[model samples]
Target chain A: MNPTACILVIGNEILSGRTQDVNVQYIARRLTELGITLAEVRVIPDQRAVIVGTVCDVRARFDHIFTTGGIGPTHDDITAPCIAEAFGVPWSVHPDSFRLLEAHFPPGEFNAARQRMATLPEGATPIANPVSVAPGFSIGNVHVMAGVPRIMQAMFEELAPTLRHGTPVTSRSWYALGLYEGALAEGLADIQDRHPSVDIGSYPFRRPDGRRGVALVSKGLDAAAVCHAADRVRELIERLGFTPAEGEPP
Target chain B: MNPTACILVIGNEILSGRTQDVNVQYIARRLTELGITLAEVRVIPDQRAVIVGTVCDVRARFDHIFTTGGIGPTHDDITAPCIAEAFGVPWSVHPDSFRLLEAHFPPGEFNAARQRMATLPEGATPIANPVSVAPGFSIGNVHVMAGVPRIMQAMFEELAPTLRHGTPVTSRSWYALGLYEGALAEGLADIQDRHPSVDIGSYPFRRPDGRRGVALVSKGLDAAAVCHAADRVRELIERLGFTPAEGEPP
Candidate 1:
């Protein structure tokens, strides 16, 4: 079985529609490349109880748990302390992190709020931020990262090599213009039934220019089965008198 | 208090990073305008058990639940059936929907797969789809809409009037181009503490041109409180020797 992961996006900005999230897609693509099945993703607020409860629940269910947002030098950045409470540990400053942050800031500028970035749950290891000096941290299965896209990507790059891998999931797709899903759903179901291990999806798209098409995608850990299913999908499209093209619809 | 809501985005395409979702932001903005608190958003796969369980769990917790995706004319579109199971009701054809869909398609073109689009839980009201002929539905507190953005927006627009609402949450923001979050975190916390009702958020952003800034946003149902918080944020930015610009940083 493939290793599974869940992402917890903790922020009020995203929930309020003030920010459009690009981090989930970036991490999802990376997890797919690393052969980890991203089973679920939840965009939640920065409420302390919500963060703590969700962290505890998802950590026990998935092989890996990634949390983004709420780790910053502000009052709403309470994810670290909440996470510590969830793990039944104390929230405090790590010596190396404190030293690194203190040295980075000039004079007495590194006050309590700035020092909050150096604080982590007991036994947490820092995930280096190449974009910023302050770091994210890993406690048990949960890896906490920044809300900013570049910083989150940097933290994930630093953390990816340590995760458990599964067989890489590959996909094959064929899209045919003028082909509607209703015309191909039955035959597609037959192909899916034949390839029990492969996951087949039929998506219909209507372009802005008024062109319509259906893209049939087959995905699985077994590349052969995935390709075989795609071949059948292409044949089905041809049988319906529509020309099948590679990749997604334009 | 504003009526709480949750958005359940059901799809494998999103989890696999094959598609970037714009529906959540659109719906979140709409919900904010309608005075409904969008507390959570979950993206799960197109699996039966997961859908059924999530629908049951969320429907009880929030005043409203909106689900997007998997309401198509394909084999993977099992949301209708799963929702029926969640409510412990029979999944069958709604006569009006069946007649409308049958008339929309030409003779013999409306196959069994297409007929599935007319199926819904026993007690459900069809939400009219202006973009496409096929309709989405609402059962109890859960409103099921199409995954496609235009269709989903149409459904939401048709259904929006019927939903219960509270005082719409308003927001005010001020961003400073040269301001770093660390320098203002203390005073920002003080401002946040003073405005007990207003929710304040500090977001740091780096533009592609390498220009970095921090945006302080205040949100609340009380318009005066939100404005008052924003004034303090702007004052804090000025005190820290940075120019505070209205709205978010460019």
Candidate 2:
């Protein structure tokens, strides 16, 4: 089984509809590339009780938990401390994080607001941020990252190399032009029944010329099975009197 | 308090990074515009136990619960029945929804897959979909919609007119060029302390000209307070020896 992971996006801005969350999609894509099955994603506001409750819930359920948002210098940035409270751990200024903050700010110039970034849960390992100096931290199985897309991307790149590996995931896709889903239903079902392990999905897309088509995607661990399923879907599309585009070989 | 809402996005494709979830952001933005607070969002897999558990948990906690994904013709689309089971109601093909589906498919052509879209909890109100005839159903406070962005957006549009409204939210933003967050920390804190209701957020933007600045956003129900807070922010920016650009007046 691929290691299951859950993402908790913490911020009032996201919930308030002020900020569109790009972190969830980015993290989800990265986790898939790492062959980790991202099972769930939660976006909670900056309320302490709710954050604590959600963190506890997800931690117990998933093999790994990743949290984004609320790690900045702002007053609403309370994810680090809230998570610590949830895990029943003492939160203080991690030395490495403090050093990174100290280096970013001039000597004796670091105020309470800027110094807030360094305060993480005790025993948490800092995830390096190349774009901005303020580091993300990892405690137990939970990895905390920044909400900013660029910074989050950098932290993930730095963090990915050190995480445990899982089974490789492969996918194949076949597209047919201007065909209704009902026309291809029986054949698609037949292909799916034959390949239980591979996940087959039909994505209806409106082309540039406003023609509709279903892009059938087959994904699983077994590369051969995935390809075979895709081929079957293509044959079905052709039988339905639609021109199936030659997609990447499964 | 405003009528607060939360979206629970369920799918393995989203968590696995194979598919990007565009629904939450759309729902969040729409909710905000409608004067409803989008308090939280969660994306779980298509598993019955997890979906039921999450739906039960969130429904009790939020004013309105909106769920997207797993409401399609496919077997993985299990949201409706699972949610019905969670609510302890018998799942059945709602007559109104079935009528709409029948209109789209015509007589004798409705298969099991197409019929799946009509299944809802007993005594559910159908939310109309203008884009596609397969209407989404709402039971109690939970509104179940499709996973596809276009379909979700259309369903939300149909449902929006009936929802309770609150105080309209308004915002003002001011940008300070070439000023770091550390430089304006104390001033920003003082301003925030003065305006408790208004939400003050600082977003760092790296300009095309290689200049960095923070866009200070003030959001609140009270337009006057938002303007007052924004003015204070602009004055503070000037004191720090940076020109603040005049943004949209509150």
Candidate 3:
């Protein structure tokens, strides 16, 4: 099994439905490519206690914990200090981070609030931010990054390669028309029982042109087992009077 | 204070990043409109123990818990049974649900797997599904629905009217250009302290045409206080030497 990971999104905007979260998909795909199992993702509020508590809980359970949002200079951006509290470490300004911001900003532009961005938890490594001068920090297993998609992406690219990884998971999808999940469930269960390692998923989708179907997918670390299960799934679909299509549904 | 909610998305496709979750956005928007505070959302895998444990935890924490996915007829669709286990109730096939499925499907097509859709926890109420015959069930505070966007939307619309709601939250957003969050953080924090009841959020956005800016938002149950805070935010942005624009940044 690959080293597991989790994501904690600290944004009240997302919870209030004022903003649609795009970071989860981006991080989820990147982690999948790196052969890390994204065990969970929690979209939480901007409160300090909640951030500290959730970070502490998830940091203990997963190998790597990625957090996005609430790293800005505003009063609402409390993720950094909360994370520091979570780790029970002394929080202070990092020299490198301070220098980077000092070089980026004009004279008098680096105010007290802006300087707060340079403050990091003790013994933390700064994640390079190409989009903006303010850098995110990595403390222990938790990687704290910006909420903005571009900055978060840049920080992730800089930090992802250094982390340990395991076997990459491979998946195969087979779409079936005029076949419902109920009709195929029994055969799918049998295949699952026979090959307990691979994970099988059935998702129903309706196309815009009045077509509807279910897409059956088999995924696992072992390519051979995944393929075998997919083949059996396709065969089962055909036996149930529906042709198994090669690509995805809708 | 408003009645709170939490969403539990149970699926492997979401965890694998193979599927981008749309249900969260839909539910979040609906909850926001209804004055229900959607406090948290957790996307978890389909494993029975994880599902049951998460469901149990969230159900106790929030006034209402909405779960999506893993209610299909396939082997991986274990949400209904796991929910039953979470509530410590006996799981059994509901008479009304079986009849609904029996009528929807042709005589021989209504197999055991299809019958699995009819099974619900004891004393659970069936949430009517207009898109599909397979109904999602409501047990105590937890409402379990299908993962597919269309079905989930329909189910939510049907069940939303029955839920208890608080005052609808009002928010105001003021956009500003040329001024970064660092320059505005101090004044914003002061504004936050003055309007202690309101939630202020600062989100930076880059426009498609190469312009960049931050949008400061103030939200609260009291519309007058929310407006007062927004006015202060607008003044704060202007005093920081940036022209405050109305609405969100483009």
The numbered model that scores best in TM-score is 1
- List ranges where model 1 is wrong by over 4 Å: none
Q: Write the per-residue lDDT of candidate 3 for residues A1-250, one digit (tens) a residue.
A: 7999999999998898888888998999889889999999999999988998899899999999999998888899898899889999988999999999999999988888888899999999999999897999899999999999999999999998888988888888999877778777888899999888899888887788878789989889999999999999989988988988986886
Q: TM-score of B chain for each model?
A: 0.98, 0.93, 0.96
> iRMS value of model 2?
2.1
> Which portions of model 2 show Cα errors greater than 4 Å?
A106-109, A246-250, B106-109, B207-210, B222-224, B246-250
Per residue, candidate 2 scores C-alpha lDDT tens digits across A1-250 of 8888888888776776666677877888888788888887778777799989988888888888888887877666788899899889898888777887888877887888778889889888999999988989898889999887889899989889877868878888888777766566667878889999888877666766767777777888898999898889888988888888865222
Pairs clashing within candidate 1: none
Docking outcome class, model 1: high
Model 1 lDDT at residue B120: 91
**Model 2 TM-score relative to the real fold:** 0.92
When 1 and 3 are scored with DockQ, the better candidate is: 1
Better of 2 and 3 by DockQ: 3
- Candidate 1 lDDT over B1-250, as tens digits, reads 8999999999999999988999999999989999999999999999999999999999999999999999999989999999999999999999999999999998999999999999999999999988878899999999999999989999999999999988899899899897888999999999989999999999998888999999899999889989989999989988889999998777
Measured over the true interface residues after superposition, the C-alpha RMSD of each candidate is 0.8, 2.1, 1.2
